[model samples]
Target: MPEHEDKRPLAERIAADIRKKIMSGDWVPGLKVPTNEDLRGLYGTSNVTIQRALQILKDERFLDGQAGVGVFVRGQGSQTIMPAHYIAPAGPGQPYRWLSEATKRQQRSKYRMLKVAEVVPPVEVARALGLEAKSTAMLRSRIGFLDDQPAELVHSYYPVELAQGNRLADRRLIPGGTPALLEELGYPTRSQDDVVSARPATTEEYEALEIPRDVPVLEIFRIVYSDNDKPIEVTMLTKPSHRFKMGYHLEAS
Candidate 1:
């Protein structure tokens, strides 16, 4: 075979094709997949090949099978997340925008505060927050859940000068998330820049998101700015790429 030839297993290739259709919205949620005979005919393969391909989709949660019935597309199709919706601070007595957004879609949402402490952040985060090499920053790590399933892992870092001796360093949950507290601390978020990328999940991410090894994770590195364009926060968000879609809307000036 040529160096550039497709070398993946036959079943995986078939599953990849089907997975692409599902992710591209060609196969909408709750739509029944074609019968085994239909699939075999379409691929000109054997029954075992079709079964193996279908099983792969089932494992990835793209399809669900019912005894004595056909397989249907899972209802929790890829969720499209609008970054703009999560940028604002929650209003008084209101839940965080992310939680509220999930509620609006009738999905239960919650967050688990995983860790809160002063620790040396990742090099990129350190640089973004203007911290000296090896300097410590306040780190707050959490996992966001939708309908009892882990949806995203978040690591947010704040400069020591800003978080020290403030509620930001507290281990407990903030009433309206960090943005509200930041605003109260006089660092109202003015704007933010986000860089998105896709990569294989790290060991910690794989365990946290409960995803298969084949699924990649999406990372959003965000730097939030305050007045005078000072960076107030640097956040890294990780989510299962196969289960989530990032949506952006830009208005013409």
Candidate 2:
């Protein structure tokens, strides 16, 4: 009997399957992977192929190898991020919601400002901010870290009229994140719209996230509206798909 042909290389396909298991919680952290012989038999592939697949996982920080024991899943697997939990402004003198959540997970977190400038944003972002053609906005870009690992890339845009000479355009970290700052600026968020999607990583995203080409990026395009449904901000967040899980909770009315 012949096998179905898959466009991706055999090793990549196998690695992808193993990655899914790890991300799905089926392959729990610190669990030993099947032996090379077992994997080869299960996948109906050669030992070299199995080794290649395992190597891919190792390179992606999903697996760790011991000299004599075996390869085991990393202690901390993919992290789940709840969008709702971090959307609101923090209380007075409180850390940003994201940083607080990371603390609860026992992970060190911080964000490094990448660039703050007034520039023409992406078409979607520009449109979301209600900007006209060829108009520019204040852009604040940064890389968020968890446990010292680059976890997400964030690019937020604000209307120049609202951000010029403001902390949003300043080259520094805004305490309590932009949500709190916006509230202080008299634009308390009244609502938000989020659109999540997965796509191939762009070159900048690939380099920024330090992920391989096989890993796609998950994008969260969020538009925050103030009073009267006026869109005041647009934030785009990018994360490695395999390393993050989006979580949401709902209550029956």
Candidate 3:
């Protein structure tokens, strides 16, 4: 049964109503959202009920509360969640586009390339890439930003043999992203395998992602496959939990 049909907590039900309004543009970015008193009157409920509902949205990053001032709608950061569904096939000629769940909007993201050189792969990365221990691979490390806030950190590893004579070694954005470059190199990607896990943020992650110690980060690690089941590239991505949410579409049998 749908959540609305169930006798869920009153706060959750109220949260759903406010969430719908926020999503539908009745409340827009940078707008001052309704206060607890206003919501209480609107819902014909007590202040406590309204506060609880607003707390749910605040946790989801839909709203931000000021100490003395009223709550306000967050801009791009809070308003958008990356889409795990409606994504292009994890294949060639189809870039892994991340779209905003808020009206499917596209945020202008900037890629800040870090290390782009051959490096010894970490034990886990090497294992995932099918490389023997002590093997060297071309590593491209970068961080993505939305509205000048660090959003996702990615590291792409390619076998030295596969990266030779290619722009993969360059510190720049490939014209159409990594998949397109792989396709041009005669290794068209045919599939993708993803592994997701969460762990406490490291010191570097805390500073780099501007997240606190108490917050955990989500890791989306994936291996790209070429035709004939050849694993060509492995990418590790990390995103702060409070700033992003992952959505999944499942098909029931």
Identify the leading candidate in terms of TM-score.
1
Ranked by TM-score, the better of candidates 1 and 3 is 1
In candidate 1, what are the lDDT values of residues 59-177, reduced to their tens digit?
Answer: 88899999999999998788899999989899988878898899999999999999999998999999998888999989999999999989999999998899977788888889888
Local accuracy of candidate 2 as per-residue lDDT tens digits, 101-142:
899988999999999999999999989988899999999999
lDDT of 3 by residue, 92-167 (tens): 4443444122224545666788779999988888987789889998999988787677887888899889888888
List runs of model 2 lying over 4 Å from the truth: 1-5
Give the number of colliding residue pairs in candidate 1: 0
Least accurate 10 contiguous residues by lDDT in model 1: 164-173
lDDT-based ranking, best first? Answer: 1, 2, 3
What's the distance in Å from true for residue 52, model 3? Answer: 16
Q: Which stretches of candidate 3 lie over 4 Å from their true place?
A: 1-69, 73-104
| Each candidate structure's count of clashing pairs | 0, 0, 0
**Cα lDDT for residue 246, model 3?**
68
